[model samples]
Target: MAADLERQVAHWLAAARTFRDAEEFASLEAWRAVERDVGAPLRRQLNTVVEELIALGDATAKLIATARYDAAALSQAAAAVQRFRRRYFQVDVTLDFIGDAVNTRTSPVLRAALTTLDRLAVASMVSVLQKANKPVPRVLVYQDKGTGASILRAGVRLWAPGAVMPCAAIKIVRHNLYRPTSLFHETGHQVAHLTGWNPSVGAALAQALGHDEELRAMWTPWASEIAADVYAFLHSGYASVAALYDVVGDAETILHWPIGDPHPIGWLRTALGCAFARRCFSEEGPWVALQRSMETRFPISAADTTLQPLLVRSMAAMPRIAEACLSAGVPALNGRPMTDVLEPARVSPAALSELERTVGAALWTSPHWRETEGIRIVALAGLREAEHPETASVWINRARAWLTSEARAA
Candidate 1:
């Protein structure tokens, strides 16, 4: 029995030692210093993870030191150490995923554009949810080096003291500012996950779907994706829709999918976004054209026949689903919908048009034409200049400068 106890204590010590080494490697002192400045919330959370590992190690060491070691006690200590090690490893993986949060490979214009987008996306949510005493979630954008479609990831499962540390990973097609609008869509994912909107939306959607179990099951998987789409629509309007088309517009890829896929068929998703725009803005020209463009571009025949009925059912329920989601969502204004919060008076068409005319006439104008303009409006202005790359670049540059300047001036 005594020999067995010794063996168990050695096992516990080994596990604890492994955790301590991984903890040190994961949160190196020098790297933590730089990350501390990048994100205090994440830094604090990382520190806590490290401390937990240390405490577990110390406790196990003391257990091994005592001349008396019971089998049950040793077993419990070993189990505790293994459990904490698994959690510590998860935190470590997240830290590695986030890395240094700096990229020198991107150009000034593209880097600035990314930084501007990140701020705007965060501010959009903060403007709404902060009033309800929710901390503004922090998102970090990284230029992805891997192949395949651009991806957005978040550590929604990361354990932390208060609220799972909301960290977003947005991998962009590096140096491609034209597609920056996707950032809003990706950031929307973070918002949906952190705000607990998916389950709320699922319950509300289930209620909306009524006795249709098939459609409900189909739509539940898509709750978060739809929430993100609606969020993008409320924030950037046409820019996001246009960006969506650019990314998944191909017929073959956009057409259909298995039930496990998180996003609905691309055509359906695009139509839903257009429907949201029409309902909210009531604008006739580009918004109407966008819906027509998506439908004409990706015909319904491209959608998988097996999933078509479910997709149709989901599309039918989307308007009310969107309305319900927004109604019960974090009110960014005086209980007004997030659309109102994102597209207020300052970013009204008249404001954007007025700024465009003035800024267009003189390229070197004060550049603060729409100092109070929301990032969405500025992004729209940038989109409007798409015909002229130089002008578009100027708008992007001004947007970066404008956004950063305001952030500092605040």
Candidate 2:
């Protein structure tokens, strides 16, 4: 039994070493490139975890050679190696995601935008976590199918506060330029995963309800969604609101009718989004205009009476909830609103009116457009100028180049 166990240990060590040396899984050149683009601070997190795996293998090998060679000792050593092998697989999975992320890119303009977003988001994660004296939360963004965006966490649970449990994968749509606003919403999820903000926010919402069990019951389901919505607004302003409309503005009443779903009803989601916008910006902005339009389309009478009051109350509390969440001083990370980090150009009324006039004439020429708007605004501008698909695509491509150059300069 001892001999057999020793043989197994040899095999396990060999396997671990093989994995450690493998090139196809995570190439050295690839990681170096990522390190350059993402910076060493974030890259170091992955490298440290990887070194741990290699050290585990070394320890396993040392145990078999130096420790007692009795049946019990061998058996214990073998089991330890096997356990690490399983854990190593988790690390392997994350590396594959990162390796792919390093190599992925689309068009020049869009790729620039995506890369900028990744830098800003990861930098924000590092800054905020450091301020709170917490572990660094490592996040990477990648492209995938579908219209919206989503996040994949590394471990079963995010055990450390502000640590992405090992890493977090942000999957963004490939070509849905108009709805990239969803990226802000997706960033909110990454924020929650890193900070475990949802549970904290949920508790706050429950406490704010003040023993109103019924409202509390309704509020808990939508806490995370609302938090994401509010965060998106802070990050992208009216553009985020516009993106929300593009994605779920036409959602059925049935989708929101189920109190069990994590999201509030479609119209209610718009109302909450608009409400958050109101708190952040003036009363006469694009968000307020969108709120009125949505409310007109889907009034409280459209929803069941039981939900109407709850939805209304939820809207009323949006401002306070948003302020409280931000006051936690972690949402934007680095204590700066996303607007500051993003440095989006605000389109003046004159510029917008001029854009409208140009679009009407089907001459989507890039004017000496001085607005340093974010990618979302540029995308929305392209959509609004849509006289045809080809024209929209051309305009968006130009807009993307402009935004990307501005981001690089910043």
Candidate 3:
């Protein structure tokens, strides 16, 4: 059965590639070459398949837009798709199959919900930054984990391995093959990255604002992860909470680290996702309901306690960062704002204290926290402390001294 599935998938991929090549008309000569190479019958068949795939994608979008909240249906569909993709594709064809599924699924309610959430999130971000009319053109929806690793690998191989760059296209890795909400979460990252909306501030916060060790550890890539989470939270609105938890839950079950993958663990990633979701949706209505869902589903822990103060500090500093961007006269892309969208829920001192206690407790015993969330907690704490001038100066001095001492010892 597996062998047969693999053969079918290979044939489909080959046909798809041939169709894609023939369709990409570069010049008159290139067009002629494609025509000569593809022949008439194959070209016709390919075109038909391409059209069918496109129509399928449109139909799927509509289905998601209209479907009622049927968890059982969603779960079943997701599982079925996963089984199909796993059985059919060799070398982890999970992403391509899932992407195709999302593109082809037909749920109008889901589509409508996604559209509404996308608009509100984008509007809020733009409004807060005072760039009210920017045109954020596209949001790619991807399924998480299987696809995420592929994306990370592909990005590294094609662009720069171990380096971050502005991706040309927006792609979403869906949380589940069937449940496509993570599409919105990834869309948030795509929009923010493409627009130059929040990348600089996020980088600066990770670098200049973090503690010495934290800065050293996280300065390279953590900013992108955190920024993506923040954007996902703001743009996803209330629906984002469930989508995020689903992704995290799926990741916890599926993703594994053999040695050197840079991404944090599934649990920590989910915790961060939940924290950001709470910040965005803690207010009222659907957003509030989403927050409650996260609490009930994921359950915050002691490690999360450390995140409280960091979240507060970061949230407080956003306005100032926006002011700095405005002062710098950085041009907005398509009239979008230059500011970080502030979530309405303010971080309380009590919350921060509780978070710290929770993190400390979790760190002491739980392998999950110690191996994963603990690092993030420390990194976040350092980042928070680095934002204050006094603390930053102290940290900088200590870092310089440490570097000098290491050099001498060497």
Candidate 4:
């Protein structure tokens, strides 16, 4: 049994060595040549993660060799080697995700555009970490087909591997390729994860909305989504909420709340978004119009008995909920309010209009604008698309052209 286990341990160790550069994983070995590549910082991160796992495998191999012929000792050694093998496989899965993302570069320009836009959103949010002297992770974005966008956040344990995800791997849908405010929402996940914003927001909601037990229960559990939505709104203004409405569909979806799901009901979510705009920007802007539109489009009168009262109560509590998200003191950020870290007024209608007016037509033509204020440009485009229904295609194309060029430039 000892001899058999020794050979198996050797095989596991051998497999781990394949993680080294120019070895079994083509994603790590030839990562740079993969389309335009995920860039230098991510390449370095990939290399570092590979080295650490390889070192762990080496330690496991050394420990197994010292086990000799003792049955109990060999069993312990085998378990250690098994752990090493499992982590080795986890690394493989991570690299494969990166490989898949880069592979999509071979698809339409829209795919690459979504990826670029995602990275910009991530970088914009991660700037908070950089400000606070915290380490930032490299980001990877891939285009996928889905009704909604999602994220595998950085600086957190991955879904299966339990390994710290090295990069913010965001999955943006192909449909919303032009206006991907969902990218900001996903990066908000990373930001909230790293800065401990979710729990902080939860605490704030509990304190502020505790007067109504049902409203407290409904919104408190949905803290993560609320934070992400606020992050999206701060970066993109009314358009983020409008884009959310576009994806969430009819009255059935807007009013339905599934217990234990992290997302609040669509009605509350959109209403809270308008509340955020009201608190941060002008009260009479597109958000008020959006709330009125939601009511008209998905009337509360159609709601069933169970959902009817809950939706009404949730709607009334939105202003307070929005205040909690905006003003929550996060310990990870050294107890600073979210508004202190991320200014909502930056993306307000007046500010976005001023940005365009100041920059002239160069905002669209210049990659510098895409580099410095790409996040706001996406917001401006989405807001313009909402405010001016006729020029929607033009604004979308302008953002698309800038994004495509930025992707190529990167």
The best candidate by lDDT is 4
Candidate 2 on 1-410: residue-level lDDT in tens?
44554576666556555544435554564444343434354456555666777677677766666445454576667777686667567666655666566545534444555565555445434433565455654555666776667766544342222224345557777654433556557666666666666766676677766556777777667777876775565555555666667567663652257637788667766766666555554556666667777777777667777777877776767666555444433342544443343332333333444545655433332323332223334434533433234575566665555446633454
Residue-wise C-alpha lDDT for candidate 3, range 1-410, written one tens digit per residue: 33333344344445434434433322233222222212243234334545544343343333333333444354443443344333323212322332332342134333332332223233333433344344433222222335441222112122111122112122334333323334434544544554564556455544444444433343234444545555444433333434454455552432232234445444444444444433433323333444355445544342246544443343344333323322221135343333233332222223334555766645434545533332233222332332343675554443233212322333
Task: Give all candidates' CA lDDT scores.
Answer: 0.56, 0.56, 0.37, 0.76
lDDT of 1 by residue, 264-354 (tens): 7677677766666566655564657766767777766557687767766777776776566555444323344455555533333445566
Evaluation by TM-score, superior candidate among 1 and 2: 1
Better of 3 and 4 by lDDT: 4
**lDDT (10s digit) by residue, model 4, range 81-129:** 7887778777777766666665555544655575566568656776678
Q: How far is candidate 2 from the true structure (C-alpha RMSD, Å)?
A: 6.8
TM-score of each: 0.68, 0.64, 0.37, 0.80
Which residue pairs in candidate 1 collide?
128-332
